[model samples]
Target: MPKESSQRGPTADRLHRVVVIVDENSNPFELGCTTEVFGLRRPELGRELYDFRLCSPAPLTSMRDGFFTLTGVAGLEAADSADTLIVPNRPDVEVPRRPAVLDAVRRAHARGARLVGLCSGAFTLAEAGVLDGRRATAHWQWADAFRSRFPAVRLEPDVLFVDDGDILTAAGSSAALDLGLHLVRRDHGAEVANSVSRRLVFAAHRDGGQRQFVERPLPDLPDESLGPVLAWAQERLDAPLTVADLAARAAVSPATLHRRFRAQLGTTPLAWLRGERMALACRLIERGESRMDVVARRSGLGTAANLRLAMRRERGVSPSAYRRRFGPRVA
Candidate 1:
């Protein structure tokens, strides 16, 4: 199947209706990411897009910093009004969502608005019955907790986001960018998403799921060791770059490079490269409307069959299916 961007449906030309639900003690990392993507204006992204509003359960709110912030209670009424709604990292991990907040999420979802749950925010969505029988994801660290709490929802803790039609869930922290860029791709087409990534100076794409295999207790390795080489390799994933090529570029032997990668990133050079390739391939499928053959060639995945195997093994979707679902077209 070809990964063609859908030339159909109501394009996400603007997000004039957007809301972010913030609660007391929200994780700053995830909340900040939401604000950066939707709350802040980027004229460079589009002349007209995203009329972002911060929705709070109460008329007044408090940030993680413990300072009270005055905000209009974009209560259930305001939440139900948006075209899209975001739930950043939850504040009360030990406690379940309050009745009012849960009701607001259900109301918004019922109104046909897209709902996103970042990190443990999925717990709230699950409480609202939004993720019943749907495949969802959360930060790898919380995978066990999530499964215990929401056993009915198929939990995928490795990937960045699980795009289950109107409901989307992402892993921790930086994974928010993966889902945010995905939303851009879905709403405005590949061109718009690519433009936004470029403006933000993010690589136009990154392949693979989130870091479930992350080297826990990551060593405080010297930045001078591997950072520069990573940037160089990322810029050239399409090139015929090999471990030997990276070794040469990084001024190290292949043996040293392999050891360094294992010590720092918890994976071999080739595996990381493969992950990056698949991730880039997914971006191309959604954004460029590129076929599998083209994506395979561009991402250095070797062949269409290899790309198919990798995409399926990683995402459980064929390239065409993924493109169609995440493509600008709804169908």
Candidate 2:
């Protein structure tokens, strides 16, 4: 299936109604992240982009960790009418889902509503059979269990999230925020998503392929990790940076740097640098940089042709098209 953007046309042209399903022992943090992304009104935009609701099989339910209880929750019918349906983290993947909840999810998907699974919520999606034969992700801690339960699903355990057409799945709690911001970007555009990210004081976009938290057997000391090196590199994204340059800065051999990157960031140095450069290009484009050559130069992509290639490879759109869709409005 094609992405929602291609199927529905530009999301900015229509209102997006989102419904989140909650159940007893649902993680409040995941729910909060969903609400923060879709529920909040962006009066600055002069109009609301999302109509958000929280629905449940029961009217009242206890939140996970037993800290609070949610009230006034709507029924499963709310999900049927939404343009998007979100499932927050469930208490356990090993347990069976309620048949009514599963049916509601299947019905929503059958009606062409986009589906999201935040953290363990992928279990719910898989149980509903919405994720069969689709690429999905969940918390790494449950990767084995998830794979064991659903062999038909292609589970990418390392990625922060997977946006598989109408079905989207996030890895864990924080990744839920990543997926939320991504949905905003896919719908409204990068400019709006960046504004929302700024309001939340969060990074507007994180590559969904980022590895989950890795446990280093020999953890680097505070000042010994690649933190300072990465910061230095970020400050000079416009400069030609190579693996050797990064290795020299970190005072380690290229081989050691590679190991560190894999151990810590779960990607190669060049791959990480390309991702950063692409991000800078996006920011420049969003700021209304009209000249492709200038945008490429400033973003360290070097040339207009290179910029076009990178944009097409990374974003699936050309520079002009991306700018037209996401650039700031000019008076």
The per-prediction CA RMSD against the true structure, in angstroms, equals 5.8, 2.7
Across residues 1-331, which tens digit of lDDT does each residue of candidate 1 receive? 1121222124456445767888766776777677666666667755554677877777767666675464664665577667777864554666776687788888877667788898888888888887878888887777888888889898887776777767888876677776777777666555566777776667554432434454533468544367788889878888988999989988889998888887666567898887677767877876645577888888888789988899888666788777776655553
Query: Quick one: RMSD of model 2?
Result: 2.7
TM-score of 1: 0.69
Residue 114's C-alpha lDDT in candidate 1?
Answer: 81
Identify the leading candidate in terms of TM-score.
2
lDDT of each: 0.72, 0.85
TM-score, cand. 2 vs. native: 0.88
- Once fitted onto the true fold, the runs of candidate 1 whose alpha carbons sit more than 4 angstroms away are 1-16, 139-143, 158-161, 189-208, 216-224, 227-331
Query: Least accurate stretch of 10 residues (summed lDDT) in model 1?
Result: 1-10
Residue 219, model 1, lDDT: 60
- The total number of steric clashes, by the backbone 3 Å criterion, in model 1 comes to 5
